[model samples]
Target chain A: MSAGSPPGVVLDPWLSGVARLVEEGFDQLDLLTAVDLPRDGVIEIVIHLVRIEDHAHVFGHVRLPRADPVLESVTSILPAAAWHEREIHEMFGVEISGHPDLRPLLLQSTSGPPPLRKDTPLVARVETPWPGAVEETTGRRSRRAVTPPGVPPEWLGEGS
Target chain B: MTQRCYAVADRPEVRVHIRDLGLACCAVEFASAIARGLLIPAPEEPGTAAVLVISGTVTDALVPEVVRAWEALPEPKAAVSFGACSNSGGPYWDSYCVTKGVDTVIPVSTYVPGCPPRPEALIDALVSLVVPV
Candidate 1:
């Protein structure tokens, strides 16, 4: 079978869309994850549902604005979405309203910006002098130090 | 590095109780080693545990808990940074969430180096700690 795009559903109707799929025999929640789209200023929520009887699959994508990324909790309908929603909330900074227990899921720090958000700088790389950087300079004329990914150049004092 | 005598008086007979802080994959290796008799599992009480084996990545969030675990052990207690992650944060040294090393949070007497050091390596580290030869 050829691959196809999952049907996109707006945030307002996201809960209903998932409920409809469940009613249509998609009983298993195989995966639920989020994609950070900085350029588009949106966070994409992707979900894969599986039907136990025939092993059929259904996919749904929901776009949420970066500024106000909030969605009604799907735990009431899928139950298993609780952990996934908690992870998304912590990493992507997306708020999952009405979640029974939306406490911190994985990450220990709650002070820093959501780690998975596109704009969150990877502080560890910035603070710790990378050992590999020393190895690169030992053999020959060293190239300009490249800023680590997810860290803004200005934060590293590389900006004029 | 403040030097302290780690050798227990009754080296061979004294059961080296272990307070396991299994955070990640190293915990799996540690457990396997214990199950296969490569390493001995000791008493559950932290007061009796001579060694606090921190097995895996030590994150900044867990710093307080790690420190508390170390403090709970009785005097002459030693800590083992079980794997590379706990040693120098392993591959997660650059991870925003991971603490560079477990030593940063607690005093570690021995550091077993490996992505997940073989259980035999852990046994060797513990032997060196108690026997002091």
Candidate 2:
């Protein structure tokens, strides 16, 4: 319930929330995205819609359990949500049940945990040593290199 | 050991065709190069494409295709790894899907260092590739 945050809704009545927004003249689906909150153990799906006539904006948010994130497809109500939903499905691993085409929209494959999931490590950072970790020599003592951001300290063990 | 000799073509109207693979943000610089006539666009067909100018991030998914394009080019071809992404994945060096560098997939003749290098940098890389000092 933060400032300017969208009204919250549960997963069960997902379609009805969207239907209500559409009924209220929110004709355009501007954006649909998901946020993976690993600490909170939930994935927040946020959808933004706009009323074409008045340019009024509306946002709807639904939180799903991180372990099993599934939501009813809104493509039927708003056709424009197809691509955004596809991206959400691909990136966040949130299953949008009943979406017509759920193929890999942008990525080459969906072989592992969807990339956007907080648990999924950005492999590039892990595999390659961060150049910033190199010690820089000043006039006196050289500065110690710190760990790369977002990467778990334990993952690198002793010396990164 | 036998010395291998290449027969030089005496065609005065010869032009080096470029296969521009604009993958990400650096492509804006590549486009700027083209818009400014700093780079000559590749023909509709890749047959005459002599230089493969890889500008931007090379994702793992595009590795095979990038290699395929490089292999498809004629002999005596060159590849210019343009921008920091093509050179070493730039800021996306830590991205999950981005390939660290294009050189890991295909051989590169020149590397232009910049997040989005100036159009002149691309021209300079091309010139260096054409005339080996």
What are the per-residue Cα lDDT tens digits for candidate 2 across B68-101? 8888877768899999988988888778788889
* Worst 10-residue lDDT window, candidate 2 chain B: B1-10
Best-fitting candidate, scored by TM-score: 2
State the weakest 10-residue window (summed lDDT) of model 1 chain B. Answer: B1-10
Per-residue CA lDDT of model 1 for B8-110, tens digit only, reads: 2224334576778888999988777657755543334434437889998888888888898888777758899999999998888667778889888788899
- As for candidate 1, its clashing pairs are none
**Residue B71 error, candidate 2, Å:** 3.6
Q: How many residue pairs clash in each candidate?
A: 0, 0
* Model 2: CA > 4 A from native: A1-12, A130-146, A154-160, B1-15, B37-49
**Candidate with maximal DockQ:** 2
User: How well is each residue in A1-160 modelled by candidate 2, as lDDT tens digits?
Assistant: 2223346443347888899889989878888899888777888888888899998887788888889999889989899889999999999999889999998898987897788887777666677778788777676785665888888875565225
Q: Give the fraction of true interface contacts kept by model 1.
A: 0.92
